[model samples]
Target chain A: LAKTTQPISMDSYEGQEVNITCSHNNIATNDYITWYQQFPSQGPRFIIQGYKTKVTNEVASLFIPADRKSSTLSLPRVSLSDTAVYYCLVGIMDSSYKLIFGSGTRLLVRP
Target chain B: EPEVTQTPSHQVTQMGQEVILRCVPISNHLYFYWYRQILGQKVEFLVSFYNNEISEKSEIFDDQFSVERPDGSNFTLKIRSTKLEDSAMYFCASSEEDISGELFFGEGSRLTVL
Candidate 1:
């Protein structure tokens, strides 16, 4: 299991692009990077995932450099509704060893 | 979009009482997991089940906690004897093979032990 480090919180206005970075210096060769979003009173939701380089979807983009020591999650356009905690996880198959979570970055999308 | 579902959105139990939390994961998912989050704290993994057996568990998953896939679709977490410290939001999640580590979690069952 690779531990990740991210900012405690970030504030952004609606309609702006927000990029949050997570550092995992000990990322393993087989580990995949994934991001999750959690809203108050609800369970965490899958946001996006990637292995290397960059991957994009309708909601966000993930950019991983060659070092694989850090990755960034980019939310194209922010909205008040997007305010939530974002978690970055690094693991491979059978992550059951432990799916530990840390104090994720609380992203506040101000309207 | 299929999703995992949990029953008894909230449960209140007396100390030493037995309690069961229920979950119905996505139909096609093969792996099941249970996690808990105390108030204002990070989520902690409890256990993971597959092939009708526990594949992994955390230290917090003591003897008092057990998971069972009693039927084809229902996965449950049973607490033998509840303690006040057991009060927390319990979440159930599932994923397809390779997991993607992308667990689809349910709304969660808030348990309050008094």
Candidate 2:
């Protein structure tokens, strides 16, 4: 398991882009970067995942640099409904792998 | 979209009582997991199950905790003795495959141990 660091909170307004960065300096070669989102009283939902470079999906994009020490989750045109806690996890993708979540970054999408 | 489902959206129990939480994973999924979150705290992994057995479990999953797949569609977690510290939201999740697949989580079963 790779320890991850992220901002405690971030503020954003509707229609603006939000980028949350996570630092995993000790990430291993087999580790993949995954991001999950959790709304109030809801289970965490998978947003995006990437091994390197960039990966885009219907909801968000993940950008990982070559060094793999850090990654960013970019949400385009944020809305009030997007307010949630974002968790960044780094781990091996194996049968025995389990996600260890940290205190996630709370994104406050203001009206 | 296929989603995981959990029973007894919320449960309140006395200390030292036994409790069982049930889940119905996605139809095609092969991996199942249990995670808990204390109020205002990070999500913690409890255990993962595959091929009818446990593949991994965290230290939080002590002797008091157990998991079972009684049939084809249902998965369950049992707490033999509940403590006040056991109060938290327990989430059940499943994945189509064990390697590089996204997990689908349920709404969660909130346990309040008194």
Candidate 3:
């Protein structure tokens, strides 16, 4: 498992874009970058995942640099309901592999 | 959208008592997992099950913890002896393929051991 480092917390207002970066210096070749969003008293929900370059979905976009040493989760037009904890995980996509979560970045979307 | 479901939204038990938490994974998912989070702490992985057996488990999943898929639709976690330290939110999740796929998680079963 690759250890990830992220900001402890971030603040954003409605309609503004929020970007959270995660650093995984020890990322392996087979590892993929995955992000999850967790609301208060709820389970973590998958947001976006990517191996390299950029991947976008209905909720968020993931940008992986060429070196793959880091990744960023970009949320467009943030809202108060988007306030949650965001986790960045780096690991292999294998059945036996387990997800190791860190403290995660807490995004506080202010009104 | 499909989701995972867990029973006993909250449980209060005495130390040294046994407890069982149940889950119903998405109909098509093949991989199941158990995770726990202490209040104000990071989520911790406990175990993963596939093909009717455990594929991986963390050190926290010691002799006191066990997992079972009693039938086709239900998965369960058993704690033989609860401790005060066991108080936390236990989440059950399932993936369609492997860890690489999206994992749908349940609302979680909050355990309070006294």
* Maximum-lDDT candidate: 2
Backbone clash pairs for candidate 1 read none
Clashes of each: 0, 0, 0
For model 1, state the Cα shift of residue B103 in Å.
Answer: 1.3
CA error at residue A47 for candidate 2, angstroms:
1.4
Candidate 1, residue B71: the lDDT equals 94
**Residue-wise C-alpha lDDT for candidate 2, range A7-86, written one tens digit per residue:** 99999999999999988777656767889999989999999989899999999999999999889999999999999999
- Residue A4 error, candidate 3, Å: 2.6
Q: Give the CA lDDT, 0 to 100, for residue B70 in model 1.
A: 94
lDDT of 2 by residue, B1-114 (tens): 778999989999999999999999999999999999999988888998999999889879999999999999999999999999999999999987665547889999999999
Question: Clashing pairs in model 2?
Answer: none
State how far residue A110 of model 3 sits from its true place (Å): 1.6
> Which consecutive 10 residues in model 1 chain A have the weakest lDDT in total?
A91-100
lDDT of 3 by residue, A12-80 (tens): 999999999988777666667889899988989989989899999998999999998889999999999
- Candidate 1 docking DockQ: 0.62
The alpha-carbon deviation from the true structure for residue A7 of candidate 3, after best TM-score superposition, in angstroms, is 1.5
Extract clashing residue pairs from model 3. none
**Segments in model 3 whose C-alpha atoms lie over 4 Å from true places:** A26-28, A92-96
Chain A TM-score relative to the true structure, per candidate = 0.88, 0.88, 0.88
Best by DockQ: 1
lDDT winner between 1 and 3, please give it: 3
Q: In lDDT terms, how accurate is model 3?
A: 0.88
